[model samples]
Target chain A: MRLAKVQKESYDEKEVLLHLKEIEENIDFKVIHKIYYPYFHFEFNVLTKGLMKKKITSGCVIDGVNGRGALIDCEPGFNQTPIEADQTIMEELTYGNAGEEAKQFMYRSASIKLKSMSVPVLALKKKTFFYRPFYVVDDGDKRSNHLLTIDSITGNFHPI
Target chain B: MKLDGVIFLVYLLVLLGIGLWFSRNASKSSEHYLLGNRSIGPAVTAMTMQSSSMSGYMFMGGPALAFQQGWYALWYALGDAGGAIINLSVLGKRMRRMSEALSALSPIEYLEKRYESPAVRVIGSVISIIFILAYVFAQFIASGKALTALTGWPYEAALLVGVGVIITYTVAGGYLAVVYTDFIQGIIMVLGVTGIAIMAFSHISLGEVNAQLASIDPTYLSIWGKDLAYYGQWGVVIGAILIYSVGYMGLPHIVVRHMSMKSTKTVKGAIMWAATWNQLFIFIPYLLGLAGIVLLPNLADPEMIIPELAYQFFPGIFAAILLSAIMAAIMSTSDSLLMQAGTILSRDIYQRFIDKRATERRMVWISRICVFAGGVIGCIVAIYQPPSVFTLVIFSFGVLGNSFLVPYVASVYSTKANNMGAIFAMIGGATTNILWTTLELENPTGLHPFLAGLIISFIGMWIGNYFGRTPSPQIQEAVQNAKTRKKLSNPLEKKISQDMASESKVISDFVRKKMYINEGDV
Candidate 1:
């Protein structure tokens, strides 16, 4: 996607590249085939791509805190949605980041494992399933929306 | 060890022994760690659900409220039963499925994954720690007070003995022991509370007391308080009830009950059973409260209601037995909190932070240690204690309700909220509650700080997203899943084969049943 400002574009491209290299080192894989920062609002493209890198983000949220993914909304920068705040949440969902366990859980393969892996969860508009339990209350588009945390994996956001 | 408290002491020992028996398996895996391998039966599940929710507040404080408030106490029962209804109808099946499907063994784990926010997870973990302590401490203090009141035992001694039993059993047996013991406690509560209420009424000419109360003030028997507002319009009563209904859906400890069930179908019969018992049991306190308003019209402290009744009507041994029921309520609540808090710390936060790769095996041991540690901390907090057990329970509920309302509701309904909304709601709610309660803010209509906090929290969440762009595609998919057509409300019976078929066959049959297909014979 076209981003703003030449310097901004170069900085973002470089940033994504660095993040991609780091992730490859950590989990030994390539994930973010593409990146979109039209708004450059949600700066954690790396994290968003981390989800896409694994197949977990492509899924839907269970009936958990307003399926917009637990913490990070699909909205990049502004809060047009009901979500109140944004924080980086990182969780280690699999034993091996890129191994069969990770692949199976990510792909929703192996029915038994999937059954053990899925839950009454919530996903974001981006189709990222927040695999945890929580609640949400929307008053309306204008006054309703809250992404209250429950529990998910560790890598979704770091403890700040 | 003295004559009067010996039975209770021995009873505690037997309870501890049972807990020890369960501990062997409890120390096996995360499934066994928090959920008892999802093998709990319906009856036990039902009772555990009830007793754990009722807490010590139901025993000592519930009766106290009933004694003073007359029919007003019914609102409490109404809210509670309504809350249970909400739990069964809205959350029971979904939660069970989520837990089993994700193998996301506990409440916080689900939160951690769902939000994909360690910030949210840690916040939740911390809340579980803070709020749960208030809850657990309330129970410990109540139990201590009850035991001491029943026998002239030292309060500290009573506290230790009572809490000791719970810690031992909970640590040893895991979820199963808690459920089975709660089953016992729930039965004891029904029989004891009902029998005692009846006996209390029977001892005095209840009609005479009613007549006396009417002579003094006709409004005493009125279900609504004597005021300008309608019964449902009042801030304290209706607000509390309203809060409770929503609160029940969000409480980590309460919802986790479904996670321990073997099947979602248990929710069906369990609901029917729970509702009947809840209605009847909740009514007992309301009635007793009404009785107290009549019999002891100018009582000084509300907490004295049960003790006065016990001392007034029954023999010492029977009074002791009556107090035992009260103790049971307190213990059940505290034990559940201890278990929940222990799970949060051990599995959700500690393991995640200290040992990234902590195994199911280590988690089991940590969970046991967590239970004991959590219980001890709560007991310490009880030293400064709420005036009564009920207040303490409500205090924690208010905290949880204020902090959890937005996220709880959002988890089920909205797809726009994200981690920001979740954390913001919690922080906003908690901050407002603390400010209001601490400052003793007297709003014109008497809205508790908790109510205000809840409102503010949702507003914060909504406002944050109001300025954001559309959710990413991944988030949209996650939201789509929330709309997964749910099945029967029964936690145990859902998704099972009617003819006792294999698990796969059960699914086909279950799917057909969900589809409203009647063409199949076993």
Candidate 2:
């Protein structure tokens, strides 16, 4: 399973907008989230994902839009959505083999089968724009934790 | 008739007032004197960081270099820009967090804690005294040269006036005064360099100068020198400029800026401001230098290009302002270096090793006395150092870079490093730098002594690391555990250890995958 920082507002109901810039850079994830955000998370087969056929380990990460990372996990259905962001706006992000051949390290990870999640925000008639940033923490036993902020109303993830 | 005298008085008064303003706190605590309470604001921090790092070379001597060379000097700005960008993205976060955690009283003190090597600290403290004095002397020479050129004052008289200004401000205000004055000086520098560039460019078109230059010498534009009169080529430009730019990491004066910043949030913003302003302002000298090529072809002394251009194009008031700006650049650099060396000698070396039990009040007084003494020593050296101001400044930077920064920068990030590495690095760098300059090995290659010294130091540090004593494993483990909560931890952390540690395994996997998707393969 993979995750993006979720906006605090709309923590429960909204589809989070995870930056999928890297995925777009290589194999496009444009068709994955064309439909409305999946409720209760469902499985979707990735076709022609460049290296999609290769099975990934529990903590392996792949680049998506806006320099966001999409990690492979053992969790249930995770709805991976895409957003539009370029290199200039967001900082550089990397996973397995970025330039360096020897060093292998990451910010945080776990062995669970985790899918990706993003909360989308659409404020047509509301005055307040809900935004939240999520942080992933590691348990002492090598497990993972995600603490995302919840939105006040309409409950959707927002990006700055 | 007393225009120079009056202006000198005004400068002295401003510096004095600022120095005294911060002296109150300095007298109360060495913390304020050495580290400025680690609460410096972004604006003051930006100005102080850039101005101190620049030294007087950017003002008078740089233009003088430009006058002799052409567009090639612009590489200095590019190198600085490159360095600033790296600082923001790479070193900035790490420095801000690491310095805060260590709470170092001096640059070397910070190094000791970071590498857990007291030997590095001792070696660094000694180097600080030696090269800083040399660098400070260079500033004094630049200041004296500017004063003499502008007012035709006696060299000794000029040196005295410059010293007086440095002592007054630094003795009174301490870091706050230095920061405030640097902001003022930074503005003056920008105004001065911009005005000079504009006035100089207005005198001739690039097409005209290029044409004139071509008629004079076929290879004038080439990086390599065809005649005796030539600017440095790409290697010199890249090598020299690269040294100027990335070299900030190794510089004691520049590193202190990060330690003095307001907060972590301010680090990025301050960096952006300092980098942009520093790059643009310092770069203007390139145009002035190129213009000097066309305007004054056979001029033996290249340093006079800016002043000559000011006199040639603008009216009297404009000339006065340009002169003020030039002085602003020179004085601004000298004052900061004077204060830095004074504090390092007094608080870091004298107070640390000499009198460990000295009261904060007494230390502040000692620092003040050192400022005065340092200024005096610099004046004496500048008045008599080997002829030219530019050479003096280059020598000073060479000594500091090869010896001080080489060891200092490397020790900051590495845990396996030791005191042996620090000593060898300085020795190796200085030895190679001297050999290069003396043997003229860098002659055809055009690599500067400072850069050569740094490269040598890099090798020296490795040699030292291999032979030096390593820390115990238990101490190393404790340092690592403590470092886990650092705000500036490497992005590739194995475990999340901060307050955010309660996140779920499910969430961590999701976020990591999402994060990796954007990051690409790293």
Candidate 3:
């Protein structure tokens, strides 16, 4: 499958590992496996009505697992990549229904920011499926067998 | 029906109309019916929460307490004045975010999900259903009394009419109906009470009233209450204040307000609205109660002070409208309580245990049925006039506050809180309140039942936590997320990234070791 991935702009593997070690000194980190989390990305041409009509480019990313859509302030670059069958997780939200949901989310954000009853119409400029990278690490604690995920993009930690 | 009765009937009809109008929308989905699709804005959220929390207790029970106890009753009012402010500020934002994250439709369901235990759901549901029903019964009785005073009907007939209207509207309209009507009722309540207070004050200034009260009985003017009944009983005084102040945090019906708010941003505006409305609305009833002692010195039932004061101060049509305010207070509270009880029954109990696969339509029907049954039962019990509205309200409110306050607060604030801790806290607090009230331990211990129960509940949480295991990492992360108000800065994010490097390095070493082993074998 042709899977699209967000360009890794932050850190390489060795650098990421070095940073992770300084944060969590207690746990004996075992193995790290990379997994792809699905998100539907959309770019929109938002028209604002004021003294002058202005067109602004905005983007949104909707979580494929929970169907939660969020407006992204800056557009992130993406590239097409071959999906590794073992590393890719399936998305629960279908691409067919995500467009309308994404549009509604973007519209709300634009209207709120513009504070206008005459909210600019949002035209979809581009839409695509993108996979975000996350590193899942096992804490080799025999007693608890804990697992934690680090967002390769943002470096946020979520213990599961 | 009299003019007042007719006005009240029209009001009831209007409420029923609103409920039926929303019924179509409410039936479309269980979420709509139970939580109004979380679309309620700040103003409506604040009003509904305040009106529901105040209950008929404001019009009847509160004034009655003041009439009997004198200025000491103002202690309750003092706490109540800040009750919504405290509740909204402390729990509003975090609870809203947490409930959404957990996808919990009911407060009881939220507790279970937070604790990750079915047992928590069962215990929480049972406690909420029982106490919320008890709270509803108090409203039913107050409604009957207020209606009887207004229309000159027999208590039985008034009980049937008043409770009947409340149940009808609640069952038909669901949460949206309950909340919007509460918003309207909230307005009527402030207007009615304020009008009466103005007229009463105009008739007798506070100084003159105090002079007369002192002349009648010196104890009537005392802060310690009439005859110093609660003199030097700071524990009792503190309990009186805490019951309405912090007490609101524990009530499932009240806390559900947080869950159904439009968003976390709703909290700031809601706190402002609630604070303003509460300052206008809460202290007046107690002051009127104090005024009642001087104005209506020969009153038969102390609870009838507000209604009698309205009739004495205003003419027929105006007084009747004021009477409508009294009924509004009762009905506003009754409907919310009924809606909450029904939600608990249908969502927390039936859907969770009896039939997990029940469709949205069936669940709505079940909720309606539960509400109707609760109203009918409440009416039947209210007809017997089981106890004074003040007594019933305080008892139930005290128990509920004591039971759930610790657990609810812990859920958002403490990551170590587990299923056993919640269960113990709930049981300990409720049992303490019941025992303290039933055994009448306040006199002997010099402590209010509510205060005693709260102490025990907190201790129980601490002890039970020692025995309970730490919550799952996912739940801990959720608690952390709930507490976070702003995104991590680049520097902080980088620091976190650095902290997690050890795990990454270990994983990298393991993978490299496996590759080297494979190469050697080849």
lDDT of each: 0.51, 0.49, 0.71
Please give the lDDT score for candidate 2.
Answer: 0.49
Task: For candidate 1, write residues B1-522 as lDDT tens digits.
Answer: 445476566655665465445544443431232234245656555655555566567666777766655556667778876776776667654554433333354566665555557887888778767877777777777777777776677777777777786676455432323444555666666666677688877866668666866786666667665432234446666556766676543356423211101111223556467557655666666667667776666877666676667767777666665566557656656555665665567656877788977654465566667666767776676654435677677767777777776775665467676777778888888788777776867245477665778878888778755644444555455555545733222321232322111111222323345335334432
TM-score of each: 0.63, 0.62, 0.68
Off by over 4 Å in 3: A1-64, A67-90, A93-160, B14-49, B87-106, B174-182, B253-274, B412-415, B473-522
lDDT of 3 at A61: 74
Give the per-residue lDDT of model 2 (tens digit) for A1-160. Answer: 2233322222222232222221122322121111111111111221111111111212212221121222222222223333333211122323223311101111111100100011111111211111122322221222222133212222211110
lDDT of 2 by residue, B1-522 (tens): 347545655664665476446544443532233233244556555655554556466655676765555544555556666776766566554554454445443466777776677666666666665666666676677666667766778878877886676566444332223444555656665665667677666678778877877787756565544353325444445556666555544446423111110111224456556656766665666667777888877766677676677667767555655565556556555555555555566556776688876654565566566666777777777666534656655555566567766554554456666668878887787677667776876667667776778778888888888987785564354345434533312222312222111112223334556668868954
Best candidate, DockQ-wise?
3
| Superior candidate under TM-score, 2 versus 3 | 3
Candidate numbers, best lDDT first, in rank order:
3, 1, 2
Interface RMSD of every predicted model, in angstroms:
20.9, 24.9, 15.3
lDDT tens digits by residue: candidate 3, A53-113: 4555666777676565655534556666676755666677888778876865554444323
Which of the predicted structures, 1 or 3, would earn the higher TM-score when compared with the native? 3
lDDT of 3 by residue, B64-172 (tens): 9989988988888887776656776778768865776675645777898999999988988888888888888998888888889878899899889888877765554
DockQ of each: 0.02, 0.02, 0.05
Q: Which candidate leads in TM-score? A: 3
